[model samples]
Target: MSDPSMTTTGTMTSTRSLSYIALFAAVIAVFGLIPKIDLPFGVPITLQSLGIMLVGCLLGPKRAFYTIGLFLVAVALGLPLLSGGRGGIGVFVAPSAGFLLGWWVGAVVCGLCMRQFMRRMPDAKGKSLLIAAFLSSVIGGILAMYLFGILGLMLAAHLTLVQASLAVLAFIPGDLVKCVICAVLVQSVVRGMPAWRLDRD
Candidate 1:
């Protein structure tokens, strides 16, 4: 027979996990509320990526992936939860769709990188945290996203690979800035509230 105490503990953990997922989903929605800057390449720039990065860094890989999946599902269900108040099935066919889909992989990659670094340096502190954060964001938030973003541009815009690649370059500078911001913010959270740290496992 299963121990009642163990069952209760498991239930509590599940509840906590769901709460975190919901909270981050709300955060992503809030980020989408920020006005986006439409570019000539047909994709708009928004702060939602910042929210995604934070989820990856804070929640770890599995939780971050599930959280992002929930957010995407909400958007798919016709919720106005995307940048520029856009949502619904139609958004999935838009030029920015690749980036939107890429966010899922990006979060997973970011979380994996963070977990790897954290494991290597279990006592990661101060500057170490910053380095881990930066590296994780660059790999997950930029590289992974661009791979899909470029492909999305090519398919949606009917552009050549070269053209799509060039168009994506415009976003690099801003994304680098975002990476730095994510690193700093994550370090601050870690230092200010130790208890809030999610399990790396």
Candidate 2:
């Protein structure tokens, strides 16, 4: 016979996971409120990248994937969820579409890397996270993200490879800054709530 306590615990875990997913999705939407700075080459810079970094670092692979998927679905539903309140199906065909794909991939990559890093780290909290988070963000948030962003520019915006790469450069500095912010925030959470365990794949 299954213990009633075990069943209750399992239910609570599932509920907590759903709550975290919803919270992160909303966080991404809130980040979209930051004004986007349009680049002459297309693809504006926004704080939404930072939110993506945080979601991955905090939520892990599976949850991070779901969180990004949820946010994108909401955008597809005509919600003004993208930066500058731009949303709807049109955005998917926009030059930023590739970057949208990046958000999905980047989050998972970041989470996977963070999980590995945390596992290996002896301290897990000292320099335990800041460096791990920063490096993971750079790998996933910047590198993985840029790969898709460039493709989006070329395919959606019809820019040449050279033009797309240059355009992507415009957003790199801001993305790096976001990485730093994400690292600090994740470290804070690790230190402050050492016991908080969210479902992470």
Candidate 3:
């Protein structure tokens, strides 16, 4: 004896979740529209990483992962949705591929961190949430992404591990700045929507 109203509510919730996932995928693509800085070695720098941070911080682990996956699917379909308007199967073999793929993992990691932190501090205020978001961004958005990025540079550019690692140093400051910006935005969201659920359940 299933309740029709409950079934309808479940269907609505599922639809809403799908909408959020697609919207965030679009958000990432929009971030890619920003101009990228081309570098002689390694890959170019872009603001797309910030989008990953934001999605993770907002959407929880599972949904954030799905959002990033959706974005990748679009890229694989030959959409000009990457920084510098590059796309197609060729981009998969490019030096930035690992970093691009790493974003999916990064989003999951960041969302997991956010969920854990928020759960531990159920009464966490905006400032506390900011700290949590910043730490998570560093761990997932920067560290995890860089690990894959370095490997990508080595494989695609034929750079030694040391050389690839060194080349990435130039982008650290910018990434840190992005972390701060993401944290601030996330903090604002928490303050504005205290009833927001990490899982959106």
Specify the highest-lDDT model's number.
Answer: 1
Give lDDT tens digits, candidate 1, residues 1-201.
999999999999889989999999999999999898666666667889988888898889899989999999999999999887889999889887999888999988898999988888878889989999999999999999889988998999998999999988988877877899999999999989987653364
Global lDDT of model 1:
0.89
Query: Model 2 over residues 72-111: C-alpha lDDT tens digits?
Result: 9999999999888989999999888999999999999999
Error of 3 at 118 (Å): 0.6
TM-score of each: 0.92, 0.91, 0.91
lDDT of 3 by residue, 61-165 (tens): 889989998898888899999887988889889887889878988998889988888888877776887898998899889998899999999999999999999
Tell me, by TM-score, which candidate is best: 1
The superposed Cα distance between candidate 1 and the true structure at residue 51, in angstroms, equals 0.7
Q: What is the model-wide C-alpha lDDT for candidate 3?
A: 0.86
Superposed by TM-score, candidate 1 places the C-alpha of residue 98 at a distance from the truth, in angstroms, of 0.5
Once fitted onto the true fold, the runs of candidate 3 whose alpha carbons sit more than 4 angstroms away are 36-45, 199-201
Q: Candidates' lDDT values, in order?
A: 0.89, 0.88, 0.86
Query: TM-score order of candidates, best first?
Result: 1, 2, 3
TM-score of 3: 0.91
lDDT of 2: 0.88
